[model samples]
Structure formats: structure tokens, C-alpha cells
Target chain A: MAYTKRIDGRKFNETRKMEAKVNIIKNADGSALFRFGDTIAIAAVYGPKPLHPQHLRNPEKGLLRCNYDMISFSVSERKRPGPTRRSQEISKVSEWALTPIVELEKYPNTVIDVHIIVLQANASTRCAGINAAALALANAGIPMKQLVSSVSVGKIDKKVVVDLIKEEEDYREGEGSTDIPLAFLSKSGEISLLQLDGKIRPKELDEAIKIGREASKEVYEIQKRALKAVGEEK
Target chain B: MIAEKKIIKQKVDEEREGKKKKREIAIPGEKIVSGKEYLPGDGTVREKDDIVARRFGLADISGRLVKVIPLSGIYMPRVGNIVIGRVEDVTFNGWILDLKSPYSSFLSVSECPRYIKGDLTEYYDIGDVLACKVVSVKHKSIDLTIKDRGLGKLDKGLIIHINSNKVPRVIGREGSMIKMIKDETGCEITVGQNGVVWISGSKVEDELKAKEAVLFVANKSYIEGLTDKVKKFFEGKRGGKK
Candidate 1:
């Protein structure tokens, strides 16, 4: 039973709708809220300030720290309040995804903390978190080479698709589903993050990345508009 | 020669005023301009033929230079910056000042000209606010000096904190905005590059008025006709007072 049609009727090269806003958190140095369909991610940036505990300070460059968490009420099954193993791993990967764009060398011995909270989750929460975190980092005025954009592309059976919804993720027909979440730097189109959750052939992964990169470009347009609109809004 | 220079200055000012209305804010990675004619300035980087913004702010073009004037960010400490800060800790030979910047700043007694007698705490105790000049800002160290006039202990005043990036707007062109606020409210306002402002006035009402004006300018830093708007703000306050 091959999964020929999309669960939501979206095109193979199409993504779930996305919404982005920046400077939403008042106290944070930078903050943003980004949404991909039902998944909602809010990110807050603090510092480039002095790092605590002393041990974590990087003498050569600043530290890029990320914390990603989904609220207890975000999912139907009720996520745990504290950090879990999966969230911890996501946090590490988000930090890695952000490090390429952020110029941490400018502030030596300091730490830039990015905290991401998922208010709702359907699928692709990590990608949405990265999106929000990128906006928040830019809003904080961190020196950066460029901005980052992320997308989650998956293959439902033989048909490779862009941005897999939860229903699509849960598809258990022929060949199951292969989830691939990716992040790309704006303009340069360099891959900063590439994660795979399911089995994928080398050829299929290449095609997924190609589709994901285009989808990320579209996301970049939305992110760019949101960033420009803020300083122009008076 | 002086008359000719004045005419040239006037023309420059007019050109700047005209350009303000069409000011565009550049986001990070956004290309400001292309070609060898324009040089990338602060907060901007040149990638091949294009000059893109490194910071998100107003894209300012002056002659052949392009720079992004950031609207908001933590203060990046630099040498030759006059900043206001509170004494966090009093040490043996120096004092630590919290300048609200990423880097920790220290004011050494050797840098202090008026350090003749008594303990360091006697001159600048913990929690004492001072207007100090940054003498040195190295990779791992920032040193402050109070060897000049108008740079020392702020005896009595109220402190207001704003985003460090808004300090330029509060100061304005040649201190025009600050002078306007001082004249309107009869207050002595000291704006710090680190965004800690000191306001001292004969009357509490005047001090508060000055604070309000400074905050107003900081909030609307990117707008055109800012001086005129600030004047109207003063007028509205006067009307309310009457």
C-alpha cells in the first residue's frame, strides 16, 4: 500500500504555512515567535554578557548556548516540564545550526543564550525552533555573517515531500516515512544542519536536501520581511 | 576661506537632512549597495561586489561609506567612550564599574587624578555612580579613567536606563536633542554610551520631564523630522502644565 497522495493534499514541493514575528519578548535582548502550521516556537536571546560558573567561558570567542523545550500542554500526551533527553539533543543541534551565522568571536569570554519554547507541536518542531532562534539572534543585534532558515522535508513512501505534518509523519503505509530536517544559511545557501529521523537512500537524501533548500529560501523571504518590517514600523 | 567652509557645511547639512526621510533599515545579510564606488563601513561587510549589513539597523550612506547604525543591542565597549556606571565593588587600587556592557570595566586609582589621600572607598565607595572615560579596551580588559572634567562621581541625580543603541538618538546631531531637552526641562542630562543616563535638576518635575523627553527620543530614534517632533512634545507638555 504505497502512500501516493499527501495526507493534506499539499503539493510535493509545498510546505505547511509559516508565520514569523520578532521582538515579541520585552525583557529579552532579542526575541521572536515563528510558526510552521500547528507547531509554534518562541525564542528569546540574552547576553553576549558575562558567562556564569566561569568554566563555560571561551577565551578565544563567545559561547553560543541554546535550550529547547516543549511545554507540558503543547502536545496531546502532555510533555514533561523539564528538559528531556530528546530536547537536550535538539538544544545541542540548534546551537550547532546557529553557530555558523552568529559571530561569536566578537565577544570573547561571554555567552549568548538562546532559549526556545515550543507552545504547540504537530511535527517539525526543531526546524521551527531554529527559525525562531535565528530571528531572535538577529533581533538581539548579534554580529552575524548572515541569517539562517530551516525546513523539514520528508519522504512519505516513494514520494519525497517538503515539510511533513504529523499525519504525514505517522503514515505507516509502504516504506513508512523518512523525516529529514535541514537548515541553510541565507544567500550562501550553505547547509548548516542536516538531520535524519528515518531510513533514506543516498539518492533520496540528496533530492530531499535540494527540495529542503528551496523551501528554506521561501522561509528566508518571510524571515527577511519580518526583520525589515520591525525597524521600519516606527 | 571661513565663509566658503561655512557654505560647504550648510550644503552638507541640507543633504543629510534630505536623505533622512528616505532612510532604510538594513537587516543582517541584506545587501545595502554594490560596486567599488561605495566602501563598507561599520556594521557592514563586503561580499564580492555587494556590501551587506552585519547589523540590523538604518543603512546610512555618507559620501562613499555605507554603515548600519544599529537600533538595539548590548553596548560594545570601546576606547574613548564616556560612560556612566555604578561602582559594583571597591578594591585595593581600583574599583569595578557596572557599565551595562558585555565587558567588565575597572577604574584604577592610578588613572584617577584626584586620588591623593584616604582609602579608594573614601573616593568611590560601592554603589557610587560616576561618569568615567574609557581609557583602554583590550580583548580581556577594559580600563576607565576619571582624569578629566565632567568625569567623576555623580553626586545627586536620578538614573534612567535605555538600550545602548539608542544613545546616539538621545544625543542627536552635535547634542541638539539633548540641548533641547535641557533647555525645555531645566535639567542637566548626562547620556552614557552604555545607556545609563544621569538627570539632575532643581525641581523633581523638571527632571522627570527631561527623562520623559530622552525616553521619547530613544523610542522613536529612527523617525524623520525628529527635532520637530521633539519640539512638539515639549509644547504638549507645556500645554498640559498650563
Candidate 2:
């Protein structure tokens, strides 16, 4: 059922307009919400002060706890609210992607919790959540080394795509193309998270990664503006 | 010689009267030390060797001058305030709403005395404004309770966005702005710094006015002399009801 327009009317390397909001939740120590087309994620930060069970204390830097959740109505099919096995794994990877970007050493023996609520899902909700989590951490006033941003690039019908929207994913699946999601820290130019759910040629994979990096770097600007806008509003 | 003496007396009297000219503005919570008045829009000023204090309890991070007023007893949730929340959530227990602060509060259905059942989709949806009491403030989490009249799911209304830090300004001195918006628009507006504002009124136009009024107050909250601006916005408005 994929069509020529399934890849969208844009060039293969184009990405949808991305926007972000910071300090969106008044009660969150730090909070942010990110939007990429139809996908939306709201992230909140709390901690860097105390630890549970005392044994969980790091004694050095703050503990990073990340929980990824999806509302029932986020997807086309209503998902029962709670963590599935896939969500749990995604949460772990998200925490790892964010751990190094934050200056946890500045908050010794404390805990910083990152909660990501996926309000809508298109194709790259997890990656979108990663970026939102970083913004929320900064919004919570949690000292951070730098902001983390993410994007997805894939190959569809032998054509390299920078950011894949939902229809693109569907079309690629029909065409037997490769899909990969990547998250990067803009400051260090480091790849914090990489996931592949489809097949692609090795050379095509490299191109996808290159596109992902560039897209993430660009998305970083949106993250910065969101935080800055929140401050200006204050 | 008699006319010259009378003219000199009148001139001296006029000069003395001019020196005593003073304007006394109402200082609600501040103790008047020397000067009886202040310049309009003056938030921070020095007079008679005494620093005129601002009206807010928190130090002005904006570094602007504000008139001093007594802090009222009403609870106005701030952006970073560690407030108590209750379990307004049904399934997965209620997620604690941290009151737009760093600490997370719980909205656990399990915390309640009764057992909630079914798919639980309709019981407590998103943006259900519930009043919760803060129980603890550890870095681990914030404990809260919703077993009070003030705490529960909110019904239909308008949710307005405003700066959480300026919540005090929107409410005004002794709820002056809040009362005005409520009286003028005839709508009940509940503000959440998390940017979830619930405004309830039968009239759609009233709700819109209340929203605009909130955004207005939120922007100019720190500046002095805002009553007239608010009054003017409400005057001669018709169409929302029609």
C-alpha cells in the first residue's frame, strides 16, 4: 500500500519541523516537552538530593533513574497504561544515553529521576523522549554538562532518509528497507544510543548514521531555544 | 514699607508650603519610616535613609522594585514549591503530581480506601486537577494526600497558561486580580504553574477574557498600578454571551 508520496513530498534527507518547550511542568524540579510532528513527549526531573534504601546511594554522584511511560491513547491502538518489556528496555537505554551528558558528579549521594511521558507516537517516540528528558533535566535546575538530542535516519527503496516520519516507516517496511534510530550528545559529538530494527547495506548504514548526527545537531538548536524561551517567559 | 513687608511674608509662606509637599501611597505590609508616598511604578527606592521594601515574600530575583504587602494566608502554588499531592490516578496507582516542582508526588489509586476497577481509562484522565497535601520532602520522593474537600478531579473549564513564578502576581494582593477576573468574567479559574489552568464559566466569552486577563496579569504582575488596566479590559464587552 506504499506510494511515491509515502516518503512524503520532501527530499529524502528532510526532517519534519521540530519544536520543544522547557519548564513546562511547574511542579517538576525540571521539565520539558518535545514535539516532532505528531510525536510528543513530556519529561520531568526530580532529585540530586536523597536516595532510597540508602544502599542505592552512589556516594559520589547522583543516581539517575529513568522511567519511560506511554499513555493508553498515544498510539492508534489503545495501549494499556504501564510498562511493557519493550518500554523497560527503552528506559534503560535512555538512561544510559543521558547519564554522561549530565554532570552528576556535582550532585553527590543524591538521586535525579527522569520521567518521560509519551503523549503521542509516530515513529521516533523513544528518540523524542530522550531529547525531552535532557531538556527536562536542565529545566529541573539539574546541573548538566550539555543537552542531548536525537533523530532517526533510515534507507527506503535505496534512498537515504535523514529523519523518518510514521508513513515513511510504513513505506520502508513495505519496500524492505533499513530503519535505525540514533541519539547523540551535541556538545561532545558522541553517540549515546543506537538502535536498528530493520535491514540495510553497510554503506547505507553509514550514510544513515551521518544523517542522524546532522539531524540531532540541528535538533539541538530547538532544544536550546525551548529552554531559552522558558527562561524569557519567566 | 508696609506693602513690602506683606509681600515678603506671602513669598516665605509659599516657599515653606512647597517644601512640605509629599505624596503618601498605601503601603500595605511595609512600615512607613519617613516618606509618606512613593513614585508611581517605583518598586525599589531609597527615601529618608530607609530602603523601601517590596511586597513579595521571596526576594526579587527580577531585581525590580515592588510595593510591600503582607503575605496572605491563601495557598498559591509556586513553580518550585514542594507541595503535597494525592492519588487521583486509578490504574498504575495515581502518578504523583509534584506541583510543578522538582519533587514528585503520588496519585496512587491504591492509596485510597476503596478499590478501583475496570480498564480505568475514564476514572482519572489527564489534567484532573486534584488538591493534594504534602506529606514528606525527601530527595527520593514527595508524599501526598488527596482525602480532602479541596482535593478531587476538576470538572469542565478553561486551562490558562502563565508563568509559575508569577502566580502570586496573577492572584494579586489579597486576591484582588483573582476576585476581579472571577467577578467580571463570572468564571472560576484555577491556575497551575505546571501551565494547566482550569477556568470554568457558563459563558465562553467570560472564559476567554479570564484567560487573557491571566496572561496580562502574569506579564505585568511585578509592576505597580495594575487595577486600572484590568478594569479597562472588562469594561464594555459583549458577544461571548450572545
Candidate 3:
């Protein structure tokens, strides 16, 4: 199978360059802006404080609330105004990714709200958001067992690709184009969140995991540099 | 990409000045770029990715700040601080509000002069918008007032929740954005990053337009010159000049 793309002569294994800035908002306990290729996500972390009565609160551990919002102009076509059902579902999945890494037991009966705003939607933004949010939490000085880093693996033309930019994502076929997004606790080497949106053979699936793991090393470096710069600024 | 390029440039500079710069003990095969390089007296707890002295233990990579210690406690509400809230209970005495803060506040009935003596139930019912004020806080109880003309129930408007910390950004330097929102929509909009917003206007469309405008500001709070964009939106709408 052949695939056509909008990008000019970009390779299948290439990843968009990514960089992140921490403490972008001085007022937030932690904040970060991450850019991967054209995808941009800004995340902020607040609290370890009391949860409102309206929101369900866990008695044994702290509650983590995540909201993923994209501006109407984030993509080439304007997204429908207001948070869509898809956004809510993504927000829920994001919390799952961070729950294992965060030391929620340390802040019992409190809440930590993570808000991610997508400024651009070139590709793999959910993964980008997860990475940015972990940095923001660390920047805020929140206690967490380890940082969570994420990457995407997909199959194109029957060959697997490490990170799928927008053009590759668009050209991907329904059944064969497999994409698996995984979040890892860099310290524990544990998978906190995993999602698969396409079909793949059993062997192919294992290959996807290996690809994701290796790509995570790069993401982990990005997170470390971002945090190190934040520490230096302080 | 820019960040990585900069890192490379920094490394090259550091290597050129290599004065045997105190090599902290490192794990033989542990990845270097992502490892946490901690100096002595750094108090952070070690995690796996952290690169620390070998004697610190193979598994210990967390760093703790030795000097900077922050005491955690209840968050106090400050005047001019934006908050998010809900109307919990209403009374002849006042409306009890939940601000998601450690303290809850009350909005006095007298302060709401526009609320006629009729069904009080009809004008502003329970769970109405809580854009009132914190007149006082004593013994963990808060006294609230909505006496100002724009401070009542939100008839029809949009409510946005910004980072309670970024309220200042939404407000801009010297009360600019808030002032523009008022001038543009001819509607009253209240912001409480503590997460309550009250908007009221005779026209639902106008109130909604005001909400959209405010949300626009909230989304791009980081960008420069947001006031112009909001003003343009208002101009495009107000005169039917589209």
C-alpha cells in the first residue's frame, strides 16, 4: 500500500522537533508550554487542596481533575465551540495516565486540577499534553513518584512509524494503520495509561510496544531538560 | 527543536571550558541526558531517571530541596481574587454561597436591592450564578454582598474558569480586559478563578456574546494585545456591520 502526504519530503520515522517551557505562568503552582512539530499544548497544575462539594472527592486519596480544551482556531478548520464529548473523554483518559505516577496519598482529601489547552493540532497532541502536564506538576513542586512521558506508534504502508505527524495520521488506513499511545512512569518503568485505536497482529503489537519504549527515552530527555531549566530558573 | 539546539550549543561551550568540572559519580550505563544531576545539599528525593552519585544507591534518583521548604496550609481568599462558586442556599438573611475555597460566603438580601420582595424564589433561585463579593470572613465563615448594579444573578452569559493564579493575566495590567468586556458587551461579567462567574444582561444573545468574548480572552491570556481582538469582535457584532 502507498501513502501520499502533505508534508514536503518528510521521512516516515521522523518526529517533529519538540521543546517545552516551564513556569510560563508565575501564578500557577506549575505550568508548561510544549511544542512538537506544529502541535502545541500548554498545561497548568493547581492544588493539593480541598475539593468542592459538588465534585466527587476520594476520602482515601486526593482527587485529580483534568480538563483538555482546544481553542476553536487550534486546527486548520475551526473546532466547534465549547467542550465536546470527545474532549471530556480525553480528559478522563489523561487523568488515568497520571494517577499512578502521582503520589495522591500524600494529599488526602484534596484535589489537583490539571488543565491542558491545545494551541495547535498538528498531530499526537494528546501525547504531547500528557508530557507537558507531567513537567508542569513537577515544576509546581507537587510530590509525584516519577514523571510520565508519552509517545505514539503507528503503522504506515505496513511498516511501523515511531511518531505520526498530521499528514501520516490522515493517510493512515482504517484497519492496518495501528496507533498505540502509552504513558510510562520514567522511574518505575510502569505503564500508567495505554490506548489502542486500530487493528494490529499480535507480533506487530509487540513491535509497537518496543517502538513506544524507545521513543519514550527521547521524550524522557525532553522532560528532564525542561525540569532542569525550571530548577535553574528558580 | 530550538531547545535541543540550544542544549547542544551549551554542551559544546561547556566542553570547550572543561576544567575537569567536578564529575559527580554516575551509573556506568545509565542514560546521561535524562538523569538528574544533583549537587551536594540538594534535598530532592531520588527517582529512577535521576542521575546521582553511585553511593546514593542504584535506585535512588529523586532530589529534595535542602534549603527551600514550603509550609502547606489552608488557602485564604484575597480581595480582587477571582473565584468559582455555586449558590448553595438562599435566605431572607442572605444567599449562602460555596466558593470552593476553605471558607464559604453569604450574599445579603438587602444588598440585592433589585430582587423584589415577591417569590424571591423566582428572581434568583437556588444554584444561581454566584458572582458576589466577600464582604468579610470571620471564624471560617464568609460574608458576601452583591449590592452593585452588575453583581446580581446571571441572566444569560458565558462563564469561564481560568487558572485562579492567572486571574491577573485575564484582568491585564491596570484593569484593561475587564473594562473592555464591559464596554463591548454592555453586560456585567464577574470572574472568580476560585471559579465563579456571574453574567447578567437583558438580552440572552448579548450576555452570551459577552461570555464568548471573555472566554476568548481567557484562552489567549498569554498573547500580547488581546484587547484589540476583543474590541474588534464587538465592533463586528454591535452595529450589524458584518
Candidate 4:
């Protein structure tokens, strides 16, 4: 468990390079492109419009649905097109992460659909997807409690690290590695998403959460700036 | 920029005194008011004793009532609002119109002009544009009528779709914006409340200029002195005439 520098030359508590833009898709109600290091994700939001399949309409609040997909060439090896079980689970988790922030009661009986497409994958695609989706929702002008920001933290070489890349993710599968992805409502400081893989002690978990929280705050500032840029344009 | 800073400083001072400010942008889930002193309205929700904003919008307070005016969103169809729609489907009894809202509107045979005696398709076929009014909206269904004046088939006009919320800005204060475009470009323009705009001019240049002016209004609607800016923009294209 010797201390070793990350492959990307980032500090143990440091995250990867991040870039985000809003209103990138013309036809969609709202859209955003988000990049964290080498990983990139694009999200588009449609509706709060009428829900299809008459029976699925909720009398009280609108339904929020998410679909997470990875392009065939996103990975080093070509991925098969279409939804797999992994994508389905990620979609459900993304939907759960976003639903709490949306004010669904305002658009009762309608459906808000969020589509997240990963154009590149080095790691932390889900976290990047959540960030993009939040921007898209804001760009779409959907009513919500606040924008959500997320980051993935993990233990590598017996040290806590923020924003894991693909190589770090692979390392987590062996021996003593843990991956924790966390999301929060930036304005309210409320935790909207938390997922863990592998094993980590309570002390490490606390440390990971603290690092993730700080990283998410930085991401939230970027989200606000992107929204303001689009607002100023209008 | 100095004047803008002064205005912002004055607003901050007013806010410190607990006076309700006008046109403050509110982010989603941000608390607008506490206790039962204010009642929540549009773009806001009542959570226990607190009224919180439900979206990104401007806070509008009228006496004890508090509401949020959303800056962006899709058009929610309302009764009696005039909308421009494209015929999507031709049915036996009616034509399904895409009003650009979440819901499709129905223009039934009964609602069509009584003068039409033959097949409905022959009168208003698919892909035709129509200016219609929302006669009724019930649940998921929206009923439209085209029998009134200027509420029938639109022929050979350039259609421009904008943000539904910007429809008001396009029309401007007391119809000033629309009138300005019409006078300058000499194009017949019909703006639908649902964010659909139709422009037809005697010349191609006039049509393009009208489109350009409407888009400029939509883009710079939030800025001050937009009417004068728009006039300058149109005149600049016409060799600075007037």
C-alpha cells in the first residue's frame, strides 16, 4: 500500500479535466454536452408533454424516464449497439437520481424523457451522464429544486482518489479497491444518488463522501455558469 | 455598466429591508418565502410552511400572492388561444393538427366551415398550414376551430418556430413589436400564441427581412431598448433609410 501518483498526474483529491456546454441540440427541448477527462456524455431532454400508452399516465405527477446508451465506438473495443442489461440498470439509476429534483406535480399526467448518450468512455460514464442530464433539464427550462452534480471517488493504492478514470476503475476490481459514485442537489446540499461497488471501511467511506462532495460543488459552479451563458444569449 | 451596477446596488439595498423585489430570477428548489405569509402560484410549490420555486424563472409577487414566471418551457395549450398548426393526419371525421404543444389538436368536420360540402381532405389536406383557435381543452384532448376570420388555411408563407415563452416578446408591448416588423418589411405576419409565426410578403427580400427581424426580437428579447435596436437593424439593411 505505498503512495503512488495517479497515471493522469492528478493529486489524490484532484479530479479530471471537465468541460460542459448547454443548448447544443437544436430540436430537443433541452440539451448539453459534458466531458470529464477523456470521458464524454451528451444528454437531451424532451417533454413534460403528454405521456404515451394512456394507461401509464400518473394522475398526480409526471413520469420521469431516462435512457443511457453507449455508442458502438465509444470504447476501445467496439460495443454492440442497443440497450443491454447494464445500460438498463444505469438508465434506471440515472432516472432515480434525477426524479427527486424535478417538480413533477406541475406537469401532471405528462412524461419527461431524458436520453444520455456516451460518446467516449474512460470511466465514470454514469456520473458524467448525470451531470449532462441535469444541464439538459435546466436548458429545457424544466422546473426543479436545483441542478444535480455528481462525481465518482474510489480507493487506489490504499489512498482515496477523486474522479476515477478507466484504468483506475479496472484496478478497483482487484484486492482492496472501492468505487463510490455520489450525486447531490447542489443548492440544497441534499444527496440524490449514492452507489458503491467493492468493499470499503466506514472511515474510508466518510473520506470518499467528503471528497466527492467537494468535487460536486465545483461541478455545480460550472453548471450554473453554463446556464447563465445560455440565459444571457436569450 | 455603471448605471447597471447602481441599479443592482439599489436592489440589494431594497432586499436588505425585507421589501419584495420585482423580477428576481429563482432557481429550482430555492426557497422564495417562509411561513404562510405568501401563497404559492405558477412555477412554485408549497412545501409545508415554505413556498419554493419549482423551476428557473422570475419571481412575481402581487400583494400576498407569489408566482414564478418561467423563462423557458414548452407551450401548454389553453382555451381560446390562437395557434398555428400543420395538418398531421387526415381522419374520417377530422384532421389531426400538430399545434407544437404536447397534445395534438382535433379540427372536426363540424367545426369546419359550413360552406364545405364534399370530402374534408379536398378542403384541407395533410401538410397544409392553418391558423386556428383553441375552442376547448379537456384532459388530454384539445379542440380547435377554423371557422372565424383569419382562422383558416394559410397559403405560401414562411413559418418560423420560436420558444413559446418568447411569443409575448415577439408581439412586444401593446403590439408594438409586430407592428414595427410589418411597417418596416411590408410582410403580412401572423404570430400564434403557441410560438408559431407565419410570414408572407410580396417580394422575397421582404419575407427574408421580416423573418430576420422576428428572430432578432426572439434572440434579444431580454435586453433593454429592443424596439429601437430592432428598428436600427431593419433600417441598416435598407441603406440606412429613415
On DockQ, the leading prediction is 1
Candidate 2 C-alpha lDDT tens digits along B21-96 = 3323222122234332222132334545444432212212111222323221112333243232323344455554
lDDT of each: 0.89, 0.65, 0.66, 0.86
DockQ of each: 0.76, 0.02, 0.04, 0.58
Provide the lowest-lDDT 10-residue window in model 4 chain A: A169-178
TM-score of each: 0.94, 0.52, 0.53, 0.84
Question: Once model 1 is optimally superposed onto the true structure by TM-score, how far is the C-alpha of residue A218 displaced, in angstroms?
Answer: 0.5
Question: How does the DockQ of candidate 4 come out?
Answer: 0.58
Candidates 2 and 3 compared: the better one by TM-score is 3
- List residue ranges in candidate 3 displaced over 4 A: A1-12, A172-176, B1-242
The residue pairs in collision within model 1 are none
What local lDDT does model 3 show for residue B239?
A: 70
Q: What are the per-residue Cα lDDT tens digits for candidate 4 across B85-197?
A: 99999888899999887777999988977666668889889999999999998876899998898889999969999988999889999999999999998899999999999
- The DockQ-based CAPRI class assigned to model 4 is medium
Colliding pairs, model 4: A145-B28, A145-B29
Q: Model 3's CAPRI class?
A: incorrect
Q: What is the Cα-based lDDT of residue B54 in candidate 1?
A: 94
Clashes of 3: 26
